[model samples]
Target: MAPPSFVSQEEFHAFHTIDRKLYTLLVINLWRDPVESMQVIALWLWLERVGFKNVVQKILSLPYILTNELADEAVTCLNVINNDQLASLTEGNDTPLMQSLIDRDLSLQFFDKHRLIATQGITRIVNEVCIRALRDIMQHAIERNAAQSLADSQKVISHSLQQPMVQPGLPQVGFGPDADVELPWTQESEVPPDDRTMFVTFSKGYPVHEWEVREFFTRAYGDGIESLHMQEVPPDEQSLFARIVFCSESAIEIILSGMSKAKFTINGKHVWARKFVPKRLKPSLPAAPPVNLPV
Candidate 1:
């Protein structure tokens, strides 16, 4: 009705025709091959980075897709299923993910016992089917995203290797043929290094700021950095030294190795990276050569 308010009767009819066709196409595809069609949809949404909340909003946007009150009900149902209180009610026996089914009233006995879940309009059997459907859909979305990412990465590497030579100024720098090399196999006695912090010494009079250095590391490694800071450098150095701490020691090895091998430069000056080693205190003098009173 709102759509009719905004457009001519003929135009509204034409739009409705196309909308029905879209629904038919979706249903037909699902009916023909459910798994593959679901996967195709999952991949598309995953690639587009569409979140569950966005889907809800999008549905509410289209009057033909969902009415106002129905949309509210849908949102209410989602809140009910994703409730944190449901997980708490289960005690430590269930994780948030496992408690999702319980919250949806998949179990009849559990549903009857819990007033919160039973009050929902859907019956236990319906809830059970809906919960399973949600899990399958989510699982497909996650798997497709991971698989697509891996395949895309491999394709990029393959394309780079096939290229005749690196570009002149914008050289693709790394470990070259050994770029994909892995760390040596671990032994039983060996443990990962605890320190992931690195000292980055920018060249004297470097034109870049401390944030730029942090951004560079983030681009090379990843986000979720513990801390990044710029401290006064030695008088001879002139420029500042950046201390970047990572959440894990593996981040240090991987990021630094990637940087060292790549030899990346900014503002026409090379940035130097090294492990942050603490200076050891010198041993105390041998009791001042025994000149004082001997105990």
Candidate 2:
């Protein structure tokens, strides 16, 4: 996508809510074919040029939003970044994200307590970085949780982190009209069925009713032929909690893409039958012989 008209932080601030669908499409397209990586980098520099040291801070400050396919796509974006880029992005002392990744339980607790609402006045680059951090943390949490039962979880986790094919109809960065244009189709599944489950949780205080759980599954699955199941377990004896599980990966993607209404404890410390294992990515284009460009 050609970069969207440079939106000012003040304008982003005026809008209190994010259109989850729109943002998801934008982010996914950007991640897939990043013609404007330099543009986004420029935007980040623009904010820095204007003396907004807190721009990154503001972007990172967004509470995690459970809407659209964003939570998933955010993870995909992080997966694309090279280790050098990730290291450069994470220059800080607290490193809450790194800490969260090292320990799944702490990350879950942190996400449970803090919620991402909207990015008001935060620069786009900063927003991307923040979301990337959140996704990476969750990805690690999922991996750690699955490690407990590695034999079973490997396939599930592998499928969850699978890369999507660039279809012809999808809105690509250079192939699109508006850089931030929203795609019309439903979000496709990156991971196939049999290797996935959507693990939704009830808050410690509010337990999900059996009826609500049934409806949640029904509504989440839509017209898909996947069987979803829920299990209730307490995190601690003192805690009354439950997990609404969708044992099909396609079903999980369906639920995440279509429904974002019901509030559930996402990023919890549960055994996800899926994890992320990174592999070297081959360049899409053949390398050109070394050529010097005029200075």
Candidate 3:
């Protein structure tokens, strides 16, 4: 098949090398299934759009692309075939040494039967090649997306690290011995229930077990956890949110104090913690004393 208009000379030459190697392997089995010609045509059509070099590169790099035993064998056979042999096969318009072997068999009655088989199975061969090509394209896209998502996550983590640890609305308390620190919520009894509760959010794509959350708080802020509740999330949900109530309001203050955001790393993912503020209900006005009308 002629090189497509979209492909450069270099790309076409590289694809031609792969084609020859594949053809060498196929010819050995041509007697069983003689649809190599149609398969080659379909591959060329896919190459025209995907680019010959790109297809070869993706196939070689992606392990997932080799889904079946047949594909594995084909790749192994292609690797074993010498480059010089492939080059010699396409050196000139005259039939190559390998092609002569196949051509010489054309006089046999079996050759005619194989030719008929190739004609009859052309549609099936084309469909199979097209399906394989589409699969490769989709797999490549998925791999690329996964890599990009990982990169974006890293960027977000880096930015979070650079942010100032001192957050507004939270007391700026220091760990030094004579820092004159004053706790925002002095006593557990005086603090509202919401002030002692922390709203926790977990990073997407990372597994966060209840044990891990309990361990993180217990280790980082002391054994002040009264209750830990994690919301059930759909399987497709990227992040998880939870509520953690502490026995002492000081635990919440310690978690939020001096931090721009109450963020922690758990299970290799960023977890955010903030004090849960409950909405205040408006006070109901008492009915005025019944007025005596024109007594």
Candidate achieving the largest lDDT: 3
The segments of candidate 1 whose C-alpha lies over 4 angstroms from its true place after superposition are 1-194, 233-238, 258-262, 282-295
Instruction: Give Cα distance to truth, residue 255, candidate 3, Å.
Output: 1.7
User: Best to worst by TM-score, what's the order?
Assistant: 3, 1, 2
- TM-scores for all predictions: 0.28, 0.23, 0.31
Backbone clashes in model 1, listed as residue pairs: none
RMSD of each: 25.9, 20.1, 27.3
lDDT of 3 by residue, 240-294 (tens): 5577899988788788895423567787866666666443321222222221211
Q: In model 1, which range of ten residues has the least summed lDDT?
A: 285-294
Highest-scoring model, TM-score: 3
Q: Candidate 1 at residue 30, lDDT? A: 20
lDDT of each: 0.41, 0.34, 0.46
Of the candidates numbered 2 and 3, which has the greater TM-score value?
3
Q: Considering lDDT, which of the candidate structures 1 and 3 is the better prediction for this target?
A: 3
Task: Count steric clashes of candidate 1.
Answer: 0
Task: For candidate 1, write residues 72-133 as lDDT tens digits.
Answer: 22222333343433442322221111122112322222322443443332333233322233
* Model 2 poorest ten-residue lDDT run: 271-280
For candidate 2, the TM-score is 0.23
In model 2, which runs have C-alpha deviations exceeding 4 angstroms? 1-194, 220-225, 232-248, 258-295
lDDT of 2 by residue, 212-293 (tens): 5555446645544344444433454221222344444455544555442233322332212122112222233232222211
